[model samples]
Target: MKLAVVGGGSTYTPELIDGFARLRDELPLSEIALVDPDERRLGLLAGMATRMLARAGHPARVTTATRAEEGVEGAGAVLLQLRVGGQAARDVDETLPLECGCVGQETTGAGGLAKALRTVPLVLDIAETVRRLAPDAWIVDFTNPVGIVTKALLDAGHRAIGLCNVAIGFQRRFAAALGVAPERVSLGHVGLNHLTWERAVYLDGEDVLPGVLADHAEEIAADLSMPGWLLRRLGSVPSYYLRYFYLHDAVVEEQRTKPSRAAEVAAMESALLEMYGDPSVDTKPELLEKRGGAFYSEAAVALVASLVGDRGDVQVVNARNGGTLPFLDDDAVIEVPARVDARGATPLPVDPVEPLYRGLIAHVSAYESLALDAAIQGGEERVRDALLAHPLIGQAGPADELARRLVDANRSFLPWAVSR
Candidate 1:
């Protein structure tokens, strides 16, 4: 099978490539095409991948390309991992929301909306190319604002699924906290990325949250350390999103404060600046290389395993809800568990989420709609409505003010902004 990874020069690309390489035997993958615009970065990655594969004794054909059409042609699966704008632009995406005294973050609030505006067009273009190049390829998107972008692709009449590691990552963390094997822990989780809830967790068919919380208080507290500590202090396991989760009064009241969107964006910016400024002196890539041995390898192997393993089940994927979520529109993008087999992904039926989950979904939907409208219809009012509908905005007047400021500040990227 031929698998193409779009945006192959990205920082995360190596990890993903390592993932596919580890899965060669299980999935019987025959070729890999790395696609990116920057030839230098692409070559750097391709060389690194070639060396790694040689070391591992795998000999799959590893090719590189600059054009989406060239890389996507005849691909069975296309992993979308492009960053619409590099870290510099993402720094703006994260800091802008905080400047307005609201949550500035990559996947929520004005920052997320801005990201979607920039990313939607690029992703749509790629989707169009895929249609012309590899009509049957399954698009597995690993982009930010996963829900919103996934919705946009479906709206543009493409088959795509948004993939975020947060769900599985959180599940593993919770399993560790509970002193149980990850596979032994069963959970019911639902909501948007970075803001999901653990509705339930069980070990041996018994509710174990209370016991785990009590027994592992110290360990849990230690694990919840970094980026945003305030939310971790409030309660709940510190998922990467401890910042934004804590800011919401509803979630705070439930003692489930995760990070705020602003905090996450800040951390991401700092990390990117560090990456760009001192590409020579950083141990991050090395650390990531070591870490890649597990996550990327295991995940990619799992993908291949699902394809040819003894148990044939479709992998849970992120795709358009299409009545899968009763409360939301049929076209809404959702990340539900999916079963993946040789044929493709089949999403599982999930029950209606909680009111808070629904509320977040609504806000995300409004933001997604505005992004799509701006990208496809060139409308500004829709964008305004999206900002107003956000939970952080609180009131219409404040939302309007925030919208106007965002439009003014990001005029270069958002050319359809209304005149101040």
Candidate 2:
């Protein structure tokens, strides 16, 4: 079977290619294709892939294409990991929300809405190309605003799977926190990407959270190095996006206090910009090599390995509600644990989420509906509703005024907007 990776020049490509090599025997990958718009970046990725395969002593043909159609042709599976706009645009996404008195984080709120607006059209174009070129291929999407982009592809009438490593990655972390092997822990997860909760976890057929959290309080506090520390302190497992959650309340509470040194925050922005800057710079190779060893890459490799190895029933956060969340549309992109097999993914049933989570789902659903409406009909009211219904907007609004300001501010990115 052939595998095609779109966004081939991505920083994550080498790790993904390395991952495929680990599973090449099981999947028997006859060919691999790398597609990217930037030839320089594509050349770098193509060269890296060649070296990786050489090191592994495997001789699979690796091809590069600047055209999306050519890259996806004859592929059995297409892995998408593109960023529609580059880091400069993402900087706008991150800062816009703060300007509007809301948390200016990417992947949720107004920032996510902006991202969805810019990304959906491009992603839809790619999906259409895949439909024409490889009608039977399963599109595995790893793009941000994943829920919205995935829904756009499905709404446009294509077969695709939204994949997020967050759900399973967190499950394993929480299981280890509770002193149980990941395979031995049974878990239930549900919500939107980066905003999910562990409803339950059982080890050796017994509930373990109460005892685990009570005993591990200090250790958990110490380990809040990644996102979701506050939630963990409040007796819930942290999602991959714990940092946003931590900052939400912090941003609100610190409104009176002079903003302290945001060194960590500044450092992160600098690092991301440097990472996404010129690929021809001398230090680029070392940077990419170091990134190849991150936890995100490791998680991606583990997921691909699980699918190819047919390693029993591993759970993943995939799209398709299919009763995992009856409160949301059956066809909506809800994140829940899914069973993977050689046939494909089957979403495991999760009980209805708690009222708070369900309420959050309602908020997300509004934005998703607006995104789809805009994509289909090019309407402004739907987009306005999306902005007003966002959690951050609610926290920072005279809804009508905030919506108007955001719509006006982001007119350039919107599908339909009144004259500025």
In candidate 2, position 335 carries an lDDT of 75
- lDDT of candidate 2 over 1-420, digit per residue (tens): 677888887767766766667656555677789999989778777776777777677678889999898899988778888866665556666665665566665577766776777778878888889889998777878888888888887777777767776665656666778776776876666787767766566787676766766676456545554433454554566564544555676654453244322333344434533544534332234444433223444445444545555665656645677666777777778777677754556787676567866877767776677766654555555666777766667632544554565566556656566454
lDDT of 1 by residue, 42-91 (tens): 77667666666665667777899999988999987788878766766666
What TM-score does model 1 achieve against the real structure? 0.80
lDDT of each: 0.64, 0.67
Task: Judging by lDDT against the true structure, name the best candidate.
Answer: 2
Model 1 misplaced stretches (Cα beyond 4 Å): 178-181, 204-207, 217-239, 248-285, 289-297, 300-316, 342-344, 408-420
TM-score, prediction 2:
0.81
In model 2, what lDDT does residue 402 have? 48
C-alpha TM-score for every candidate = 0.80, 0.81
Candidate 2, after superposition: displacement of residue 18 in Å? 2.4
